[model samples]
Target: MTRGTVILKNGKVFIALGYSNSDSYPSGEIGQMLVKALSNSSDEETVQIIRELIGGLQKDEFSKDCMESLREIGEAFYNKKAATKVGLDDVYGYYYDYSYVYDIKTRKLQIFHFGQLEYSFKKEDFPFLRLVVENDELLYTLSYDTKNKCFKGIDAEVKKVKRMKKAGKSPQYILEIAKSLSERIHYVVDEVYSSDCWPNAVQKGVTFYPSRKRLKFIFKENYGKWNVYIQLPWVRQGLIHNCTSRKAAMNKLIAYLDGNWESFQSGMDLYELYEDCQQKLMNFYNACDQISITKDEFNESVGQIEKEFRGKLIPLEELDYSGWTKAFGPDRAKKEIANWIFMTHRHIFDCIQKA
Candidate 1:
C-alpha cells in the first residue's frame, strides 16, 4: 500500500491511502486503518506521514486531480512554515539527507542531495518540477507552469544538433600532376603564340586564343579532374577530353594543335563572336524597353532558361518549346529575346554538332 496526505488551508488533514497496483481496499477497512494509525500516533509519526505525502507528490505518483489538491496543500504548508521561521528539516527531515528547503527571506526553493546543494529556484521563476533518477542519483528537471506557487510535471527540454560533412585533403599525386600540366601547357601556348601574345594563366591551367581562330585551347582542372578542351566561338558546347595522367593529356593537346593549327590560321575571330552576341542582345532589350519587365526579372528568366538548357544536351531542333514559353511568357518578341540570351550564355558539354 502507498499513503499520502493533503493539509488544507482550513486546518483539515486528509490521508490518501491506496494500493500500488491500482487496486482499492474496502472503504470501511481503509477508514479503520486511518483511524487506528492516527488515534494515538506520536508527533514524529505524523510528520513522517506528511513527508511521505510530499515525497509522493514530488515523484508524480498521483492522478491529475489528486496531484493538484496535494500541490495546494504543499504550497500552504511551505508558506506557513516560511512565515513561522521554521526550516524544512522540522517538517520534511534532516538537512543531511536529500530534501527541499524553502528560504523565508528569498522565497526560493533549494534542492539538496546528501547535504550538497544541487539546484535553487525562486518562487516566481519556479517551473514545473520533474524528479529523474540518473546514474542512481535523483535529479530535478524543469517543465510546465508554477504560477500557482506549486511545481507541476511536464517533459524536459530536448536539444538538437546538426552534423557537418568532414573535410578531406586532395591527393599529393593529383596536386603534383596539376602543377606539372599547368607549366607544360603554359610553355606550349607561349611557344605557339610567341609573336602575337602570351597565354592567359588561370588557377589550375592556361588558355591561349590563336590569332583568327574559331576555337580556343583551355587546359584546366574541372571538378577535381584535369581537362584539356577546345571552346568554339558563339557555341554553347565544346570539344572536351578528360585525362588522368599529365603525359596523356599533353600528347592529345599537341596532336590536336598540330592537325588544326593550319585551319585556325584563317577563320572567325573569338572577339567578333562575343561582340556580335552582346550587340544583338542589347538591341533586342532596347526594342523591348516599353515592356513592363525589369532588368532583374529578365536576367532571372534568362538564368532559369540557361539552367534548363544546360541540364541536357538537347539540340536546337528538338528543344522543349513549353519550357521557354513558361519562362519568357506567351509574347513572341519576349520569347525570341529570351531564346537569344539563353543561346549566348547556356553551357554545353560534348555537343559539338550543336556548337
Candidate 2:
C-alpha cells in the first residue's frame, strides 16, 4: 500500500494510507484506511494498533492484508516516538508518510495523488488564476472552506470536451484539465476568503467568491476609493483530469486561458506590487558599468534593513496587505485606483494601435 503524509506550511495535515492497483493495494482501500486513521485524534497509538493488525494479515484474509498494510504504515509513525512517553512540548506530531496535504494556515495547497490526482490555487487579490502543473496533471478542480472546513466539488461536464479529440493526444488533454482545475481552485479560495468586492456588505474584511462566468474585470467603489476585483472557482479532488471529457470548445478555451491568463491579469494591473518594485528598482547607471539591482538583491536589502530597524519594509508577506497601505499612505483606500487607471489606459493604447 502507498502511505504518505502531506504537511502544509500551515499546520493543517493530511495523512494518507491506501493501496493502488498499480502499487501496494487498491487505491480506494488505501484512501479509506487513511481517512480512518486521520479521524482518530490519537494517531500515535493508532499506528501501533494498525501495525499489529497488518502483522496478522495472512491465511487468505483480504481484510487482514489491507489492515496489515495500514498498520505497517501506522507503526512506522508510532515507533518514531512513543506517544504516551513523549511530553506535549517534546512531542512531534505526524504518522506515516503523507504525500499531499493542504495547509490553510499557510495558504498553500499540496497534493500527492498517485498520478491520478492534480491540483491548483487562486489568490484573493488577482484578476487571473494560477494552476499548479509541476508534478501531477490536473483534470478537475477542488475547493475547501476555511471557516466551516468543508470541500466544494464541481461536476464539470467532460464527456463532450472537444479539445482532447482535436489535439488527438491523452497527455495534452490531461494537462489541459490540470490547468482548468487550478483556475477553479483559485476561484474557490477567493470566495471563502474575499467574499464580495472590497466593500462586501456582509463580511467586513477582504472577501473572495467563485463565479461560473468568465472574470468580468470591474472596478468597485468603496470607502471613497475604487477597488478592482475578479471571481473564480475551486477544483474538487479526483475529478481534476475530467476536463478532457468536457465539451471541445470550452476545454480549448480553458487550456488557452490557463497559459495566458497571467498576462491578461498583468494587463489589468493585478501585479501592482511587482510593478512598483520594478519601477522603484535601483540601478547603477554609471558612465561605463550599468548594473541592474535584481529583485532578489532588492528583497535581500529590504530584509536586512528591516531586521536592523525592527520594522519590515517589504509588505507582501504581511497578512494585512500593509505594502499597499504604506505605499499609498493617506490614499491607501484608493491604492488600486492608480492600477485601474494604468490598466485602462494601456487597453486604450492597444486598441488605438490596432486601429
Candidate 3:
C-alpha cells in the first residue's frame, strides 16, 4: 500500500492514498477510480463504491483488478511526478495482518492523511460513556508466538460463531460523560503509554476542528500491529497547564489518558489535588494503558466468545428490555417510559444538529 499522512493546522482538512492488499487487485485501480468518482455525476455513490472496493478487505488479498484500478485512481489525484514519487509503502503488511486507506479528493489535496490508527471523542459534559457503533461480530483466534512478547495469547482456534443471527446496520451507541476542563491557545504535549494488549490500536480516520486557531496532532504507531493513535497533544496540554492547580491538571490529564470514566474514576478521589505540576503530568500519563477490547480490535471477537462459551450466555432477544415492566411493576415502567419521552423531546434539537 502506498500511504501518506499530512497533518495540517486546525484540522481544517487532510488527504490520504493507500492500496488494498487483496492480491486480486491491481496497483493503479484505486487511483483511477478516485479520479472517476470525482468526475461522476453521483460523487457520493462513486466514492462509496471506491471506498468499499479498496477498504473493505484485508491486506494483499484483493483481486488484482481492484488493486490496479485503485492505484490508477490514486495517481489521477496528483501530478505524475508527485504521485509516482510519494515514498509511502506499508512495511508491517506481513506483521499486522490488516490494512487501511484514507483519501482527501478535494482541492489541490494540500494535505493527505492516512495511517492505521484509532481515537475517540466525547462532550466535556459526559465522561462515563461508551459508544458502540456498528455491530460487527468480530472473532479472534490464538496462536503461540514468542515474538508476541507484549501479550499472552489464549490458545484457541479460528472460527465463526454458529446459530447467531447477523445484525443489520451497525449501531453507533456510545455512553457519554462530562467533566469541567479549561485550556489556553497554542501549546502541545506529548505522552507515551502502553497498549491494552500486545497488539496496539489499529484503526484510522480523520477529524476536523473548524475553529479559527492553529493546532497540531502528532503520534507515531510504535505500539503494536494496528494499535497506534494520534492526539491533539497541544490542546490537551494547554488545558492541563491552565487548570486551577497541579492536582487539577493531574486529574484532567489522567482523565484524557484513560478516555473512560469507568477506568479513570476507579479507586481514586475525584477531587484529589496534586502538589507538583511536572509530577502530576508524569504520574497521570505514565499509567495510561493502550489496549482495549473493542469489537474492531479483532475481525471477530464475538465468534470467539460464542465458540468458547457455548451455553454460558443467553440469546440477546431473551433479555427483553420491556421485561423490566414486570419486575419493577407496570406503573413504574410507564413512568420510566414517560421520562424517556421527555428526555427525547428535550434533546430533539441536539439530535437535529448532529443529524
CA RMSD for every model?
Answer: 30.4, 20.5, 24.4
Candidate number with the higher lDDT (1 or 3)? 1
TM-score of every model versus the real structure: 0.23, 0.23, 0.18
Off by over 4 Å in 3: 1-45, 48-165, 169-267, 270-272, 275-355
In candidate 2, what are the lDDT values of residues 138-170, reduced to their tens digit?
332332222211222433323212123333345
Cα lDDT computed for each candidate against the true fold: 0.34, 0.32, 0.27
lDDT of 3 by residue, 1-355 (tens): 4332111111223232233333321123433343444344554664465455444434453344334533454432322333335552332112112222323342111212122222111121111111111111111111112122111222111110110112111122111100000011111122222233223222212211112222222222242212122222111112223344433433454344333322222211111111122233333223322333332332243234323322322232233233111223223323433453345433533333344
Write down the worst ten-residue block by lDDT for model 3: 175-184
How much is 33 displaced in model 2, in angstroms? Answer: 26
* lDDT winner, 2 or 3: 2
